[model samples]
Target: MILKIFSNNYIINITKSLPRGVYRILPSEEFKKDDIVVFEIPEETKKYLFDRKYVPSIVTSMMKKVASEKIDDVIEINNNNELIINSKNWGKVYKYDSYGRKLPEIDVKKMKVQKGEIFLLSDYSDRSFDGRYFGVVPISSIKYKVELFFRF
Candidate 1:
């Protein structure tokens, strides 16, 4: 099994099956109701039709397009404490105090993002299965940014 680290979390292979699916991992507290997450299909399994590379992207794009109207503003703070605002609609903005802070328990109504934390975007407006379904995904699950792929 190949292991990947996203942020400070770890994504590992487990033999047991989960309610949502077959794979499972420890998630971060920051994972909320509808955060977008990427799952990489193992190289050995790529031959299957379900392993298509564009599947996830197409889903993400469609989700973004449908939720365009509900998208909220994203506020980014630069190193100099300058706040940069992007007009594009996003799920939500979360602030973390430091790089390795654990995600807090879900309390969407009362929870506020802390400084230095990451801001996550949910995939849809409806109660679709996502971060909320599985819980916050640990940063370790991320293997690396999807750069390029070569199929054998």
Candidate 2:
């Protein structure tokens, strides 16, 4: 994963496969009338697997099994490059692995500031030791965004 921070916002590019079942991989740069950009994983990429044959088939099956779990949110890239996500609600944070034992209370709704560090949120809970547990991250730590190039 790469994150490029501009003057006001940031662009994130992911090189690795998304967290198992992320529906949207790369969002389109174009803007629709609704002022939202849609993202979809290419059908060819969706059906292609690296080495495992059954993996792709299984993933396809799981996709059908959990169709409702897909996310269809609107993302707006501002002039400053800041991504304005207009959707059902604000973002959510899951709990971290370590937090499972300590069980820290994280209030996602109250989280206002963007930390400088890479805070790993839990996949299940929000109250976990993420940036809140450690400290603020420095802007210099950010790198480049991931860019996926397609050849026609």
Q: Taking the candidates one at a time, how many backbone clashes does each contain?
A: 18, 9
What is candidate 2's local distance difference test score? 0.27
How does model 2 score by TM-score? 0.24
Q: Model 2, 21-98: lDDT tens per residue?
A: 123223343222222111222234335331324233433211111001112323333444222344322123233333
- Model 1 residue 11 CA deviation (Å) reads 16
| Model 2 spans with C-alpha error above 4 angstroms | 1-105, 114-137, 149-152
Off by over 4 Å in 1: 1-105, 113-127, 133-135, 147-152
**Worst ten in a row by lDDT for model 1:** 60-69
Question: What is the Å distance of residue 119 in model 2 from its true position?
Answer: 8.7
- What's model 1's lDDT at 28? 39
How many clashing pairs in candidate 1? 18
In terms of TM-score, which candidate is strongest? 2
lDDT of 1 by residue, 1-152 (tens): 22344553433322111112222234433333233334433333233212433233322111101111112433443454322335333333233212443322343333233432223334323222222212223243432322112111
